[model samples]
Target: MLTAERKRKLLEVLQSEGKILASELSRRFGVSEDTVRRDLRELDRAGFLQRVHGGALPRTPTSVEHKARQKESTDAKKRIGAAAAQLLRQGQLVALDAGTTPLAVLDRLAPDLSLTIVTHSLPAATVLAEHPRIEVVVIGGRLFKSARAGVGVATVDAYRLLRPDLCILGAAGLHPEAGVTTFDSEEAEVKRAMIAHAARVAVVVASEKLGTVAPHLITPAGRLTHLITDSAAADDLLAPYREMGVEVVAV
Candidate 1:
């Protein structure tokens, strides 16, 4: 088959099977392993797939732009956010990560909850600024436009110093083995710092991210204190996290 045809088929197989082995692809396409590897490399650079050690995984939702991601899983994110917000109480110091999921959590916060929120997320800070009972601290840094959040040495340093009662952290993928992944390295650094100092780390992500792995890791799934997802997640899908001692809260 032609290169374009082979790449398209590869993506199709990867999406259907959730991963691709280079050896298997070479045999199936009647192409040399070198040719199959070259095609995979091209697809990876095009953001069509993520090449792993001996195979490829689907390109994660984080590969898309921030605005685009906001539209992809609206309802699931809302449920997750509401569940995460319910975990909060008065007099808590919380760090809100950048993303629509965090915004959903902000939406569900009670007007009288009375809390201080520290964040590097521009959007999360904007919503918190209008809350009557909440104190908002915006972490300053160079804007990471893709995530529409602050990222840089300053962002990482600030999170390292503050020990928040909880962190409503961001994540691109939450896999059992690959751990908590993000697409961007800088975003990963920021998330790593947040996870390091927080008393509890909670992630509000859709069920789609449950078993997927992204390019950069923030922390292992075992390090997480809580995993809040939509009810659509299957029992098997959540089992790994639960086995790791993560409190699984499916809303």
Candidate 2:
């Protein structure tokens, strides 16, 4: 087939599947692996896809709307959820941050695992309410409509009285240099308080968040005990956290 024809086919496949392995594409197209890589590169350059280790994923917008964002990249979130859920055990008090990723973690939680969960996330509180064994504590404060989270002086004050065994943080960005950050200042304060009050902190991020830095800084990389992301995360990208004594788990 012509090069243009093959490239077009590759784009179609990648669009439908949401991801495409280089080797598989090469085999299917009867082309060299280098050619497949080059095709992926071109597509990535055109903003059609993102090149992962051995594959390409459809280019997703970072400014995704809240409801749509919840469904996008679900497989990766599920894997991350499984890894995060494994960290929980009976009789431990946990704090779940409000975000699409943390909500995914709630879905994977074991029904029989008894724990007290303190959260300002309305969605998380609703999910935890249905779990018979888990005790849910909703932190009260002025509600943030966009994020569906409560954040204010009241929320921070309430958090001070309870110390959690673990805090599962959902971040907007994770820069090796900038540490962890979020877009909203109030949310950043809440996250920082959660980090301070929890015995351990786990930052859950998708691979795309690794190199990106956001406006509001929350905590430094050293504060986290663990960083959980998808298996697609590059080892070199996560090495800095590992070097800082933070356990990095790729789900």
Candidate 3:
């Protein structure tokens, strides 16, 4: 088969199975492993798929631009944000991770309650600024344009000194085994720092992220204190996370 033909078939398989293995593809295509690897590389560079160790997983919705991400699961994210917001208390410091869902949590924050929100998300910081009783602390770092968030050393260092009562994080993928993951390594570093500095960590996920695995692991699922997701998420999928002693809140 032509290289293009093989690539087309590979994409079809990836779309149908939601993942692909290099060795399996090589055998199926009657091509050398190196040739299959080259095909994977080309597809990855073209934004067709996310290449991982031994296999490739589907590129997640979070891999898209911030605006595009916001358009997906709009109502479900609002419910998740509302549910996660209930965990906030007056005078407690909170870390809001970068994502539309985390920002949604701001809409539910009580206007009369006093709180401090520290975040690397530019949009979240902007929204929090409108609340008179809320103090917003924006982390400094190089901007990750697609995520509309900051990453790199400056962002990580800021979180190092913070001891937030809770960290409401967003994930590109949330799986029973793979845990919380994101596509960017720098974003993963900042997320790890937030997880470390917070007394409790809650991951806010939309339905699309559940059961998926991204390239960069943020932290293990067992490390989380709470998992807030939309009601549309299946109980079967959440069972494994609950088994780890993490509170599962479906809104």
Candidate 4:
């Protein structure tokens, strides 16, 4: 078949499967593995797909800025947040990570429920200030402009001082193999520290982030006590996490 024809069919297969392996594509297209690799490279360069090890996944936006993220999935975030809030207990100390979804959790908290909250998110802390019954601890450090959160040596150091009962974590990617990942190194460090300081960790994510990946690695799915996401997430994508002992809650 012609190269153009092969590439077009490759994209159709990728769209149907969400991801494609090079060897499989080569077999299906009656081409060499080298030709399949070149096709994937070209597709990735054109911003049509994301090349991964041995495969390619559909291209997804990696916007870190708050305003850009705010435009993506508000209702899903609300459902995920409200579902996460139901896990909270009065008087338990909770640590919240910095992300639009984690901020959603703070927005859904019961007005009268009392709990001590620690966070690096400016918006989350600001909202929590109105809840007089809940003591707010803001970690001070260099601001990560993209996500509008604090992340630095100071933030990690502060986290070492207290152990939170639960941590509402965020992720740039949540893959079973790649584990939990974020886009920035410092932000990953802060999240790692939060996980270390918390007795239980709950990763709250929107449906679109499922099966996605990012640059920096946090802990694996096995370390999580709970996985909170919207109902739109595919069961096939979440199955690995459930098998790994994570309590998967789809709201």
Q: Best-fitting candidate, measured by TM-score? A: 4
lDDT of 4 by residue, 129-212 (tens): 888689898998998888888989999889878788999999988878767888789999999999996888999988888877
Models ranked on TM-score: 4, 1, 3, 2
Candidates 1 and 3, the one with greater lDDT: 3
lDDT of 1 by residue, 1-251 (tens): 87888989998998787778999989998988889889989999998877777877776665447898888789988888889998898999998898878889988888898989999988888888889999999999999998889999999999999999999987888877667888889999999988788899998889888777789889988888999999999898899888889999998
| Candidate number of the best lDDT | 3
What is the lDDT for 5 in model 2? 94
Q: For model 4, name the residue pairs that clash.
A: none
**Candidate 2 vs candidate 4: which has greater TM-score?**
4
What is the per-residue lDDT of model 2 for residues 84-131, given as tens digits with 9 covering 90 to 100?
999998999998999888888988887789889999999899988899
TM accuracy, model 3: 0.82
Report the alpha-carbon TM-score of model 1 versus the true structure.
0.86
lDDT of 4: 0.86
Candidate 4, 238: how far from true, in Å?
A: 2.4
User: Model 1: runs farther than 4 Å from truth?
Assistant: 1-13, 21-36
Candidate achieving higher lDDT, 1 or 2? 1
Q: Write the per-residue lDDT of candidate 3 for residues 66-157, one digit (tens) a residue.
A: 89888889999889989999999998999999988898998898889798889999998888878989888899899999999999999999
* Residue 154 of model 4, lDDT score: 99
